[model samples]
Target chain A: MLLDDAVLRAIMRGLHITGSFVLFGNCVLQGWLLPAPVKPWVQARLRVISQGSFAVLFIAGICWFVLQTVDMSGAQDAGDIWQALPVVAGSTRFGGLLIGRLVGFTLAALALWLGWRRGAAVLAGAALAAEGWLGHGGAMPGPVGTLLLGSAVLHLLSGGVWLGSLPGLWVGLRGLDMAQAAVLARRFSPLGVVCVIGLLLSASVQYLILIGSPAALLNSGYGQLALLKMSLLLGLLALAAVNRYHLAPRLPMGDELARRLLLRSVVAEMALGLLAVLAAGQLLQLAPPAMAAMLGQSGG
Target chain B: MKLVNLIALALLLGISPAFAHAFLAKSDPPVGSVVHGAPKMLVLSFTEDLEVPFCRVAVSDSMGMNDAAGKPQAVPGHPNELMVPLNIQMPGKVSVIWHALSVDTHKTQGNFSFTVTP
Candidate 1:
């Protein structure tokens, strides 16, 4: 039997959150070829994780797209979805962009297998960025649309570079040399700063366009969820700060305790970042104040 | 490459013709206007084509009277323009509430009131 509508929606939401983490996790691994190939065993295990995440991301993405077709077609039953799918994919902007994501990600996955690390990273990042186009920003008109989509896309990719890279940082820190770990930490700090700046600017533009008034942050479901996401992001940033100023300096001095502490903070940061992403998934489902009559609003 | 073709097509289609959720751009009788007589129909222009089945428009007067609005229709050759026939005789302040579902499945709703001095 087919799943209930609620069940399918829940599955789609879950897929979005999980797929983002995993797909970006795979992307994160490519920056420096973590668990380097010189150690064949570690590299092999990392590849397996990469492969599994890619598979999950692909499957979940397909299911999510199919659900959207059913939604747009207003299909009452599974059988009708077959007829609706072609029209949706051919005609709608959402469908076309989604197809583009599918293709980009597929190529990214293929490139990863072919050991084209740099190319694969770029493809995956672009795919991740493209998802922002399916959100509220991409639906706007004229130069406003261009501005919003560009900011939102950059916001997403910058987020990926920051949060998506955390899991890999944890892995990279494992059984790690003190000097090398310190160097890695130092190297990422500048990139993280740039991403933080990018995220802040883009998020402001998005809030202006989507939420309209700052008052909506307290009043609407969409605003409330965004509030929660921002709270979680701030929590992550706090943890990151602790790791950056307090612990990282100690690592260069061959302090084992500092290394462990940094790892713990990184883990906490990653966990909070994941929660932020989950909140984002929920926000995407809710209707922004800019639309809707404050009741029965729909947009995905 | 297929990916390139698909991305190019998506960019061209999205950037040129479509944007986001269908927000009410303008409406018949204009919002909160004092008109001389009762208008026979309500016209709504949105930012995007609507999914007419789920989209709805209604006009109700202050004196607990509801006006008849025929099935909402897309204007001839105008996918973005929606019109609903309205029947109103005795009118005071006519309240209009519209809920629109864009063809992309985004839904938006709002309500406004207009005075009909008759």
Candidate 2:
């Protein structure tokens, strides 16, 4: 059988995205949100998570590259991928961009090792932004291409700030006094709002550039997957609203019940965000409806 | 923000959605067309930028003999166009098969034929 499998590629892409979320979230939590002088135990655990996420990104990224090589070269088997690797890596724009992203990831690791939390976050964000070049946004031509790609980068960075930070919040809330927890939650709320606005604006731009018509939005597989992702985003936003408006306000009043509920809500938001990422992975594989319609005309 | 507003205005004004995936847009010989004489080259234009090294365009005569002169190459100024030199001297029907991998890693392929009259 051919080595080019869409399902496997999508799964690998999802894993890569998940890794980006975690690493980026970790950076934001460390540098921007969490108060300095964290408990040693908390710092240790966060460090472990950060390291683990890097490993996932590295492994999944390599696998994605291999799968892309197989798909691009029309390889028939394992051996063919080996022969095609150099040509794919050397001759293609995708290869060049992948190399640049790897370099960015490497810089992120070095920054973290040097205890430069802000630098690490910037590097991680840059790496995630480079992913825009590997998707539909990059394929667009001319000035509109720049617009689409910029929107994609903004969407990803906002997603990393919002969805990726959930774990940090989950971890930081543990064993904290109600007052401290409330303080932390309040600090995170404004960031969430900024991210939500960014996500909305960028998503709107992408929708206009990618789907355009209502018919295509409802009828095409890409559009349907996009809708599913939007649904998950809505779920996440609802859960975030509850945490920020209802539960967080009660935390400073020593409402233990509200604290527990907020934690659960964070968990729910993380789950929905993960599903959204997976949907995004699948969406990348399918052509947008407008392009699909053009393909249909040419019998592609 | 200004850029976004402009793009939104353009889209609202009915600009075509940006394209992805390398779908065959047109070809030099033209799919299923009859030409008076053999063309020196085949030019296949796609809707997106192609990864030239990974792309394949094969042209064969009715007897199943390869008629492509050498390896297919990218047209110098066209990122989406692939050019294959033709070696057909006497042609009844020439078959063309192609597989293209776009820069975004979307794959597409198709086949067509054209008749050449003596």
Candidate 3:
């Protein structure tokens, strides 16, 4: 059945963003979180996640491109450079974004193949970086778009490290040697720290873009939901801190209670993160600036 | 735990307001506004930059026919604004109907009436 345009766009955007999260998250987990003993398993899992998500993203992206092509042909500004390029090259904004995505996708595919062949980590990193650039960061224009793009990059990276590490941790607990698992956890911690920092920076930038003004915090539905997301993230951060400083140390000594608590907390954090993602899906549809302006006028 | 589940449900339900869009901010020659001279063109302004090609603005006299001289043209430099020239030259009450697809693909349509004085 033919879907409504808004619904279709929302689905496309959600698929793209979610696929990105999976791709980056899995990579971070493999590179930083998995211990050396279980590195092979983690690598395999990352490959699975990356390949699966990319397949979905590539298909959805192509569908969106086709739809956009049809729409652009009939566009009133059809003759403009921006509108002509996807069909012509170096023509329009949409064309630029499309080209960026194409380049990024190609790089990512090649990187995946190389990674499977035990390619250099640096090469894989470069491909992933390009993937980030083309997916959301490269699509943005101007200072605001640049800021948004940067945030999107961090969001993908941090989300990858946090969410993507879970399965590996679960597997390590199932059968791996205790000392090896502990060592892995230790190695993963520093990467987690870096990912957290990136997440916070990106999220802050995104918040600034969305909120735009202080009044928006209380005015628009989008703003209110964003505040809720922030609160949830703060709670998640507190839980993460506890996991890192308190629970992680105890795990090496085989403290059952600490392990249980940590597991529960991580699950909760993941659940909250999913909720945040869903909220974000909704927020992207809202008219933040207009709503904020309306609220300002009403308040005055 | 039940309380938490209930709260989550409430939050999910409360999220209905997120489906907002670029509504018609205003229109020049306000809907049904009586004017002295025949408007040379009809103009519409939207709250957000609309995706062109899928948007249209049409004007018709009392008979409910299209009075547009040719295809509607997007206002240059303003993707949100659409203009359609009027072909009629008489003092008659005209109805203006506009429909547009927002960048997000939300379809919106609205209509207004105005009289052109001889």
Candidate 4:
């Protein structure tokens, strides 16, 4: 099947989010979870990952912008798209916000290059937060709109903390000795707990507003995509639980089998996280049941 | 606990309201109604603020000739309302077709008709 604009946009959104998660996730893992006095080699590996992630964000962000401008302008020719580009970038609200986000991304890159990992992460987080405005969360009006935007920001950052950190844990474990690996694992567990709670709570708030009713969850296309995302997250959580409760504890005792299993589980959790992100990317392109109902009403 | 702190933060920001999408809420020269004469302009009220440049309205008489004098413009101080001038001089069934893009980038379009009795 020919990939429609929505499908292409979804793919770009997924890639964009993956980049943000890795950038912000690495920052959190390095700043908060990993034991102080991190090895230079491990930091070097993370730096490479951060740079690669920045590249993904820039490329994917550009693709998403081009697609949205075309869709908004209904431009059928390259010349029309070119003409629309300046108007879109300078005149439209979405374009204005995207320009601001581009600035944020640039600052994040500078911070990363300067070896200010925490500052890079903060800038990345701000860029990700701006995404909430680009989607339905930003379209909402009034005080409730304020709350929805807040929930969107919380959800993205908390998710970044969890899904983004898996690679960090793996890289750290691979390079460190058994004792240090155990310490890293333990330190990460509490952070994971906090993030999971944040994700669930913020998601619930968004669901109530977006889905409107429980029945809609099974009925609407947006709701179905959301359900798929939630299921993927549940799978990730189960693997995480096994890694935390059953595997990490055994690592301290020098159980070779447990260490192997924990590493494998972390990889599996990352896969699930990526799939969940893809589902959410598609979900953003669709109007929720509540909004869809309004869209259905036409003067004709 | 860190979990409690995170949960509390999420709850603090969890308030929600109903959803929104721009749609034609109402229009002057009300749909399918009879107006004594050609109104100076047709006004469309939408449920959300619109991006004026992308919005347009076309008024066509029974012969399919365009009756709209100019492009639609947002009413001053009311971003959700669009006003388009009409060029009709005689009584007939006139159709108004419109396409609008809300400030949020949601696009919606529709058409309606009203009778003109001269």
Using lDDT, give the best candidate's number.
2
**Ten contiguous residues minimizing lDDT sum, candidate 4 chain A:** A291-300
Off by over 4 Å in 2: A1-4, A175-179, A293-300, B29-37, B62-64, B91-93, B113-118
Report how far residue A120 has shifted in candidate 4, in Å: 1.4
Interface root-mean-square deviation (Å) of every model: 8.7, 2.4, 11.3, 4.4
TM per candidate, chain B? 0.79, 0.88, 0.75, 0.82
Q: Model 4 over residues A207-298: C-alpha lDDT tens digits? A: 76777577899998988999899899889888988988999998788887888888888889988998998888888777778767656444
TM-score of each: 0.73, 0.91, 0.61, 0.87
Residue lDDT tens for model 3, A1-300: 388654565466556555545555555555555566565664566566567766766776565555455444444454552454355234333444545664565565566566532232333333334434433223333344455555665576566566545545555544355666666667767777877777777776555554555676777776797788788778878877887899878878977777677667767776776666556555654555433334212100
Docking quality band of candidate 3, CAPRI definitions: incorrect
lDDT string for model 3 (B3-116, tens) is 234324434554222112345666677666788887777777765455555577678888777678876677898766777777875678887767666554344566667787
List DockQ for all candidates: 0.11, 0.50, 0.06, 0.34
| Candidate 4, DockQ score (0 to 1) | 0.34
Worst 10 residues of 2 chain B by lDDT: B1-10
User: Among these predicted structures, which one has the highest TM-score?
Assistant: 2
Clashes of each: 4, 0, 6, 0
From the highest DockQ down, the ranking of the candidates is 2, 4, 1, 3
Task: Please list the residue runs of candidate 1 whose C-alpha ends up more than 4 Å from where it truly belongs after superposition.
Answer: A1-14, A21-25, A32-38, A294-300, B1-20, B27-44, B48-104, B109-118
Error of 2 at A127 (Å): 0.8
What lDDT does model 3 reach?
A: 0.58
